[model samples]
Target: MANLAKIVYRPVGLVGGVVAGIVAGAIFKRVWKIVDREHDAPDALQAEYSWPKMLLAATLQGAIFAAVKAAIDRGGAKGFERATGEWPGS
Candidate 1:
């Protein structure tokens, strides 16, 4: 049963992760626009952007991605358990 649940959860988890990424990207873009007054965040090798700007963008993106991923994963697991009466994670 546990193995079956794990199997069932693989696709759910993958979909959840992809959804999280999309959501986090949108959020980060909006935040970057508001905070930096720019349409796009600086890339690490953009050459025009300073080290501080690149690092700040990376840090903010990472934080938002992590938060959104965790929230989505937790919600998916809870929903799965509610539907199947089995927790997906150890």
Candidate 2:
């Protein structure tokens, strides 16, 4: 635990998490938007891109989830621990 603690405050995890979140949010947003559009739902996605808010929300949430998941999944891989490297846990 101590050995891996070095990266606890590192920007790598935060940046990575934000990136992942943004990607996931964007994908989900697109899917929902298309579905809503098909049914002519008033809750359809924005016609114009709201990069500022959308990206910020996505990145922020994504980063948090990514970081937590990473931390929990720490410790080398389950099976074949010695064979493959450990998962990125935080």
Candidate 3:
């Protein structure tokens, strides 16, 4: 039963991860605009952006992605458990 639950959750988890990425990207963009008054964050390869600015953008983006992924994953797991009475991780 637990194995079956895990199997069923695999696809759901994949979809959830994709959704999380999309959401996190949007959020990071909005946040960067607010923080820097720019439409886009600095890319590491961009010659005009300073190293500190690029690093700050990278770190902020990473933190946002991690947070969004964790939130989505936990929500999915909780919903799955409620529906199947089995935790996918277990």
TM-scores of the models, in the order given:
0.95, 0.36, 0.94
Candidates ranked, most accurate by lDDT first: 3, 1, 2
Give me candidate 3's TM-score against the actual structure: 0.94
Candidate 1 residue lDDT tens string, 1-90: 888889999999999999999999999999999979954899988999989989999999999999999999999999999999999896
lDDT of 3 by residue, 9-88 (tens): 99999999999999999999999998899548998889999899999999999999999999999999999999989999
By summed lDDT, which 10 consecutive residues of candidate 2 come out lowest? 72-81
The residue-by-residue lDDT of candidate 2 on 1-90, one tens digit each, is 434543442354456456666665565566545644542212226655455645554565556556655643342223213433433332
Judged by whole-model lDDT over C-alpha atoms, candidate 2 comes out at 0.47
Q: Which stretches of candidate 3 lie over 4 Å from their true place?
A: none
What is the Å distance of residue 87 in model 1 from its true position? 0.3
lDDT of 3: 0.95
TM-score of 2: 0.36
Best by TM-score: 1
Q: Candidate 1, residue 41: CA error in Å?
A: 0.3
What is the C-alpha local distance difference test score of each model?
0.95, 0.47, 0.95
Poorest lDDT segment (10 consecutive residues) of candidate 1: 35-44
> How many angstroms is residue 52 displaced in model 2 relative to the true structure, after the best TM-score fit?
27
**Deviation from native of the Cα of residue 23 in model 3, angstroms:** 0.4
Compare candidates 1 and 2 on TM-score and give the better one. 1
